[model samples]
Target: MKKPSRIVNFLYRLVGMSYVHESVSEVREALAEHSVGTVAERWARIHAQGAEKLQHPLDFQPGLIDLHDEMHDMWRYLVALRNQASRGMSAHLADELEEAADFMGEVLHHVGLAAEATIPDASLDRGPGSTWINIPAPPAL
Candidate 1:
């Protein structure tokens, strides 16, 4: 199968990176609010806001559907944790929260790799449509 052009790959990676950033920020906020005993209604609001924010970027990259679902699952877990804490059922939640944070870090690392892979190598010659221009330096004074 023919590989996608570098431009296409770069666009996909850029959009994916944006989605990952938004997801990470939302999860971090949710986790912080949960730790502070935020109410269930507030959690629901945050969930809706995060979903809305991610919808467009997620649509840009069809390959990330699974990741999008995983994000929702993580958000649900955070909301549940908040509910549990509110009910005085806190037990090992700190550990769970830490795990979630670690998972997000891993996701960020992977997405960063995907984005980085598309960057043009500095040592490679620019192909067709390259805009780089080399001008000879003026004679030394």
Candidate 2:
């Protein structure tokens, strides 16, 4: 199996964010299945290619930037869930799955929208279903 740090580095490169050392640690501690490697690599390739075309901006899907942001957010939550599992802390796995479902839903929802409809509402939240659980922030951050 690929190590967590490597998986995170791959995601960071794919997600249009500066790669950080901590992301690897976050992955090691947070993720369980760690079977999303293929998807992560594909996303990274898309992101890196998108970034290369930034200067000739007309060819890009303008919402590529927002996609990167959402990707980063997804990684952040996955890392948290992984960490929670590591520490024997209580967590609602259902909520974690719901959050993932919601994020993926939003991504697909906007994929075919008109350019003018691409902007996401700033007040959007990342919790599952309707209820938001208040988990304490990670100590390292």
Candidate 3:
């Protein structure tokens, strides 16, 4: 995921934003089932929907439904629970997903990392349903 500006990050933190890196169990579950296709859909969403055209449009969200609806339902759970900042991060992810042509490949490459070691790392050991898509943070400026 692209780095959010300091101001945006602060604002997100100020709002207690539990987004982006936060665990969304549905995504993990979809990954468990569809695996590569789950991440592929996110990439496909960027190509088809184009974050530039719509607001926070994501593969897992409610905007465009090109691939499987199962993924959408997974992210939808997070949408229902989190605030707008969370949704905005979905937009951020979608935007970055477009730029990240090999994103799906990366995720799929690391798919066998015992859950905790997955690309977008989240810990099921953390507690009930604790699974996050920890997109790698950008390098230091």
Q: What is the C-alpha lDDT of each candidate?
A: 0.53, 0.53, 0.45
Over the stretch 1-141, how does candidate 2's per-residue lDDT look in tens digits?
543476787788797865433575666655633435666667667667655644432333445546656765775676666566546554566466557757765665565343323324424734443323333232221
lDDT of 1 by residue, 2-57 (tens): 43465876888888732232465667875775666547666667656544543333
Better model by lDDT: candidate 1 vs candidate 3: 1
Clashes of 3: 3
Q: Is candidate 2 or candidate 3 better by TM-score?
A: 2
Ranking 1 against 2 by TM-score, winner: 1
Residue 90 error for model 1, in Å?
Answer: 1.7
Q: List the residue pairs that clash in candidate 2.
A: 14-44, 30-82, 30-83
TM-score of each predicted structure versus truth: 0.27, 0.27, 0.17
Q: What's the distance in Å from true for residue 116, model 1?
A: 2.4
Which residue runs of candidate 1 sit more than 4 Å off their true CA positions?
1-88, 122-141
RMSD of 3: 19.8
State the displacement of the C-alpha of residue 69, model 2, in Å, after optimal TM-score superposition: 19
